[model samples]
Target: MSANKGFETKVPENEGMDSGYMSGLVSELASGPLSEPISEVGSDSGKRISVSVEEEQLDSGLDLQISEQLSNLSFKDVTPTTQPLLVDLEEHKPSIIPQLDRLFMQDDDGDTQLHIASVHGCQKSVSTLIKVCPQRAWMDVSNDYGHTALHLAVLSGHDVVTRMLVLAGASLDVRDVSGRTPLHLAVEARDERCIKSLVIPSPNTPREKMVRILNMRDYTGQTCVHYAARAGRFDIIHLLVNCGADILAGEGLAGWTALHMAARAGDAALARAILDKYGAAAAARDFAGRSPRRLAARTAAAPAFAAHRRDDTDTDSDSEDDYDSESDEQESLFEKLVQLNNPINVV
Candidate 1:
């Protein structure tokens, strides 16, 4: 040890500086002589590294778990960004003020929230909006296209929404720019559910009102049945007829009935169904004094009508033959009875 600050400690030089001794000295300097066993130190360092790796893995696992939870809890509405519509008045009590007035807020296209929700098939929003609607008439608010929410709902194939609107007293008679009522649009869309929804009997809608709606003519003077008939929807035509659509009633300048439209379109099945359902439609004349039977004669439905007539003729001939045979048998039996009664004089 040197007392001076600049002095360095000196050691005696060894004349026998063996390589093994030098290596031992180096090892001792690198690791303090008082340090723990090499194995223990190495294990401790390994444990530290392993702990760091384990910590990283744990953090990653936690992150993955959190991500999975978030994915599982994810929710979406009709639109991803848009929130649900107004609260249902009968279900949840709204904390804030009622948004009934907001429902009437119209866009540039004059479509209200009801109309938008209806077309988007947002059943929850539609149900809430209908519940909170200030008036039944507001449900009929139309867009620039003159389409009410009901019309848009039906046209967009949102049958449930259409039914909701119909039950809420939305007018089915409102005509659009195309002069088509909701019923007409339903038939045009060929949506059986929407059609049934519209025609389903409701206490708010009278039978006469439903009939009027069913037969209500569009700008083209075509009723819903006419549209169904023109489209060769025999089932829909039958439905409309059962719903009080006048099959024999004429339309437009031609005054053509649904049968006339079916005949013109060469829908033999539809023509037959119509004529069979309402026999008067066969003889029913259009404005041109042409009946559906006459129209069908020139179209592809002629053979169907011919076969139908032949079948009718055969049925009538069979009935006549049975009547004549019965009459002859009765007359012969009566003569035998008379002869038997006078058998004493004759024999």
Candidate 2:
């Protein structure tokens, strides 16, 4: 009566559209194999590193140009007695300091002398390099791998170098060739002090900017939390969450949540911490459509954890088969937990 509100309309051109065919086309366009193989990053040895040709290709414009410029320069590490030039740099005297810049060794890997000092955990060398190199040389130049000196120091677990880099005005959120920020690398190394150094704001940096960095993701769509979860770094996890990391962030490895990685990694305590704080993760589904509850059930540590609580003892069981023997009736409390965790269902 009012305006034919109950009537439905259809576009004339779409009258005979095949919905199934259209859906198949979409699936085909969306489905493809991943290009890169899985490989570990951030070596503990702090050795010189090389970038893949593929990664080199991925960087465009200015990054490529800088890589070309760095290719021509080379620096060999000099033993203290072998090179008087480097030692003379300690004076930071104006007349000799400018000459020190010409001796800049863009190592074979494209690292400046500053990068080498940072990676090797030589704080004295880093300080001297900062004092003597042209002001820009300490932080601005990245290697062929797109890793700044700060990135190298953090990845190599050089906390002293990392702290020094931060205090000297290094960018906190610089990414490497892998598109991983310093925070991501620190989380992987499980180094809490270095993690703190990167996350804490510099004197000039705004607090809000630091908050944004807390949740920044890498090329794989995984955040710093995902790396922390994988490494089972409880302290880092607590630090990140307290610093404004969103527990509900569901971006990473095939859409796998941080809870998924923690549950799979036999870290029931960390997984529970996540659930306790962000209950919604319990019902969150991964690419496989499995929620955290179902995923947690599959972990051998869950049963071991349950056993440990029942009696104050060590639970070194290698298998979860014993848990499989239990009847479906045992799952009632878990079901209730799932219901309770879903905010929509809570009374």
Q: Count the backbone clashes (under 3 Å) in each candidate.
A: 0, 1
Runs in model 2 deviating more than 4 A are: 1-100, 103-105, 132-138, 287-289, 301-347
What is candidate 1's lDDT per residue for 1-347, written digit by digit as tens?
01122432122224333112122322232233212211111221333111111111111111111122211221121112222221122222232123334446677777777776666665545554554453567888878888888887887776666766766668889998768898898898788877877786665566778888888887756788778876789888877888788878786646778887777668888888776777766667666465566556557886666665543322222222334555445434433433352323432
lDDT to native, each model? 0.59, 0.54
Q: Give per-model TM-scores.
A: 0.61, 0.56
Q: Taking the tens digit of each residue's C-alpha lDDT, what string does model 2 give over 1-347?
A: 00112432111223233212122222221121111322222323644223221221211112111122222322232121111111111112343333444435465667665665566565544554543333443475778877888887776676666766665567777777667788888888887767766665554335677678878887666788878877776567767877788766766444557776676666788876766666666656665455554555667546433432322222223345534434233343333433342424533
Error of 2 at 7 (Å): 76
Report the poorest 10 consecutive residues by lDDT, candidate 1: 49-58
